[model samples]
Target: MTGSGTPPTTIPGSDARSNGLPEAAPNPGQRVLVAGGGGYIGCILTRCLLDRGYRVRVLDRLYWGEEVLGHVIDEIELVQADVRDFPGSALEDVDAVINLSGLSNDPTAEYSPEANWQMNAVATENMADACVARGIDRFVFASSCSLYDGLPAGMHDEPPQSSRAAPTPPPSTTASSTCSRWRAIPSARCRCATAPCTAGRRACATTSW
Candidate 1:
């Protein structure tokens, strides 16, 4: 899951901001901060932002090799900082924050539950607080729809509830528990999606398979 944030500015050729997200290009020169911008999804998103004329700054620990960004490393302002230890000052002059920093998968989270909690839950909360304190209101929290696998087969389309509306097939794991909590954070903007993408993942899967 990867979260992206942008101020209320209109993008060219789209009415994307009608959903409380600020327009992506109401005006040019808006600066965006991509936390964990070196990861798989972050790398692609950063490239898109640059192509769209936004100034991008990426903060990533680069646990993955830097090769994903080799072509664009020179094009972006890269900062090597762990999400848990990042400072608010880094967000200065930033118009929005997209938090993609966290353990990327279930095996990693299951292996190191403590670190997972800190990175996925604790660090996320800290980042949201810092963004709010710094007056950066646009926060997009990317969350997995895999958690929805827990839902009953027939209830997938039900209106979302503040609590679990159906019995889950399996007991919750550390990641799901923490994600449920993160979903409830009043300060952060969470996009509760069930894919690795917004719309394209499912479309591509159906077409390819």
Candidate 2:
């Protein structure tokens, strides 16, 4: 969608290191398809990408409204669609993909487990498959530290030894864990970033495979 406004000159949390991307950054101007690019985290992330000179294509259902991206509406390509039912054509001309689409919080997941699974797990798998089919090599899936929620409070960043002993986790945690397993895809260089709670701008520990 095109808008008349200019892109915002400054975004509060636009620092590169704090965005949780890997040390090896993509070259500027590569088109990055950001699924769920209208949500809270996605809005900030889309802006950062634009500021860094990457062309962004946002594919979002806009459940929270498109106003979040109002400033940059004209600066990038915006595709309004659900990630679960995303069209194959949407991936055309995209150099890479950053999947941020999912039921983000526990309350939303608890309210509807089926939708959560579809959005977080099934959609992620489908997106990865789509990327592979199109020969897109770099796929970044936004996972969560919630997978370790079953562990002790201070044990989130620790190894998963304790997490294995935890009881069956909720849908949100399971979905995030499922997405993390995408690193096993042989044809793609997948990176899963275990995102921490967002306060302001912060760095996340990423495990690449």
Candidate closest to the true structure, highest lDDT: 2
Question: Which clashing pairs does model 2 show?
Answer: none
Instruction: Report the error of model 2 at residue 180, Å.
Output: 5.7
Whole-model lDDT, model 2: 0.69
Error of 1 at 46 (Å): 0.4
List TM-scores for all candidates, in order.
0.64, 0.73
Q: Which candidate leads in TM-score?
A: 2
Tens digits of per-residue lDDT for model 1, 18-55 = 33234354534778888888987889988977876788
Clashes of each: 8, 0
